[model samples]
Structure formats: structure tokens, C-alpha cells
Target: MDIHEFLELPHRFRWGGVGGDDCMTFPASWALKCVGVDPAEDLRGTYRTREEAHAIVDNYGGELAFMDSHLAKIGAKRVQHPETGDIGLIKAMTGETAVDQIETQIGAIRFGPLWACIHPGGIRATPAEFVAVWRLTA
Candidate 1:
């Protein structure tokens, strides 16, 4: 399915460990699989943070190729459309950049920092708190 179709899926806020925690981790991958993209082939299993995932999707041609191939499977293009939910690549923020300084001051808190924007909702919604939304067209 296209990113728009993927975005249409009901999103449950994911944190971690089968319930909720902080990172979007499995939810994002699951979302992609829900949209018909094979996680084993499309995603790298070693990502420790959303930022790492975003970096891969951005700089790694292999990951982009995976997204492109899957988009074709759903008859969707990678074009940025206003009404579609694009795959959101995110990262964690720490130190003074965190959403809550006090909470992070004691240790390290991971926050969803939007790295990549995907369109539509049916595909998948990562557990990480959504920071922004975008649409893909054409």
C-alpha cells in the first residue's frame, strides 16, 4: 500500500516492551509490515534509536530502495502529498534539548524528534510520540 494507505491504519501509541515506554521501535516496523512491507527485508534490525532509523532511511540507499520497492507494491509513489501519511523517521533527544529538562536531568530521557515525515495513517504509527506530520503526493 501507499504511504497514505499505511497512515490510515489505526495507530496505537507505542513506547516499548509490549506496552508503552519511550521509543517507537517495534510499532514503526510493525506499521510498515501492516502496510505489506516485509520488515526482515526492509528494515535494519539493529537500530537502537529512532534517530538511527531516520539516518538509515535518509542516507542509506538500501533502505530507501526498500521503501521505494514497497511503495510500488501498493501502487504509490514517493512523492510528497499533502493528504498522505508518510513514514515518520524519528530520533531521541537528550540533555538540554529534551522535552522535559527536569526529568532528563536526573538521567537520560528519549524524546521523539521528527527526522523523516511520512504520509497517510493506515500503514503504521510508531510508539514514539509523533512530533510532526507530512503528506505525500503523486
Candidate 2:
């Protein structure tokens, strides 16, 4: 399935599933798996922290921003489609402090690296709202 279809599946935010940042890495890793790419191999050691994940994405050659640095450089308008293997940059909610608040003011979410299945919640949507979807492309 495509990115939107995969994202349509249910998702739950388990901060400590595959890793602490599983919320970010799990989906991205799953997305890669859907495309028949083994994230363990293709994305090995790419992310030790959220910032590292963003850095890997930034170096991947997209105009999109992984964190505030690139976001400031490219702006929100850079986000377009929600393709598999694409990254979704979302803003963290107020009073949310899971990881290092890179760009808390703007809040950011990324759904890429694709996965085999979707999470309990669609993308980064909570019980209330779903923010923007940014597709990571080459």
C-alpha cells in the first residue's frame, strides 16, 4: 500500500517499543519494510536520538526539514504529499516533553522510513487532532 493507506491503519504511541523514539522510528522503519527495504540494514545506526533521525532525513536530499533547523531553512510550505518512505514532520503538542524539544514552538512530526503495518492512531493524531503530513522524497 501507499503512505496514506499505511498511515490510515491504527497506531499507538509506545515510546519504548522498539526503542525510546519508536513513535518516530517504528513508523518510519515500518514504512521502509512495506517498500521491501529492511530498515535494520538500510537505516542501521541512523538514529540514536530524534535529532540524529532528523539529520539522516535532512541528508537524504529533501527540501523538508527534519527538525527546526531545516524547518526554518525550508519553511512549512515544503511539505506536500504523504508518500511511503516519506517523512511526516509534525509539531509536538503543548506540555509534551518526550524527547529533546528540538522545535517545541513549531512542534514537528515525521512519518517516513515506512513500515509493514500502521499504528493504532493514524500518523501522529491523538484522540483529538492530527497535524500536518510531510512526505519525504528524494
Candidate 3:
């Protein structure tokens, strides 16, 4: 699938859980298509509630640590500026569970100037400065 098609895949999922159609898996949809690797493949279906998700994040020592450790092993390189097809992370002001102002970041994909992630209704371009991003290679 091309970038346009890849970006559209998240609409098919109902957003919820740690790995089903949540933050990690949403952008992961693009990685799976572009490089034949699913970033959240291991975590999918492993947790279903907010607390369980927090435990998983803790297991990896924090959210960015988990993303950095995982994305690197799969051929993605962290970049200062993300282009289209790059995986980006940003701090989200979601609510109380945010840790040290990190990982509340929903992993998203760069689509020109906007970063795409799963929203309540569907996929939408969210406006938040990326704290970190990973460039994918084929």
C-alpha cells in the first residue's frame, strides 16, 4: 500500500485498548505497510485497560524508552525532523495519567505538515510539536 492507503487503514479500527487501535498501533499501521514490520505487534491484545497500559509502559522504563528500544530494532532511526512516512511522538495534555510530560504522546505519522493519529471518530491530523520521531527505511 502507498502512503495514502496506509493513512486510511486506521479508520477501519475502533479505537481502545493498549494495542488494538490505540496510539502505538495507529501509526504502526503505516510501518507495517511500508517496511513489513508492525511496531505494536508484540503488544497487541496484551492489555485492555488504562492501568494495564501504564504497567506495560513501566515495564520498558517509560514510553519513549519503550518506543526507542522497539523502533530501533526494527530499522527505524530517530530523526530531528520527520518527513512523510516518519513515526513521530509528542506530549499530549490528555489528563492526569501523564508522566513527567512524556508518553501521553500518541505515536503518529507525518503527513506533510501534520502528524496523523487515531482520534475518537477516526484518523485526524493532530497539531502538537513532536518530542521525538523515527525515520523508517524500506
Q: Cα RMSD for candidate 3? A: 3.8
User: What is candidate 1's TM-score against the reference?
Assistant: 0.30
Q: Judged by lDDT, which candidate is best?
A: 3
TM-score against native, each model: 0.30, 0.35, 0.82
Writing each residue's lDDT as its tens digit, candidate 3 over 107-132 gives: 78888888887755567786778989
For residues 1-138, write the lDDT of model 1, one tens digit per residue: 543443354543322212321223332443444454423344434454545644665563543453444445544443332222444323333333345433110001111332322222112222343232222233
- Poorly placed runs, candidate 3 (over 4 Å): 10-20, 95-103
TM-score of 2: 0.35
Q: Between prediction 1 and prediction 3, which has the larger TM-score?
A: 3
Model 2 CA deviation exceeding 4 Å by range? 19-21, 38-85, 94-138
lDDT of 3: 0.74
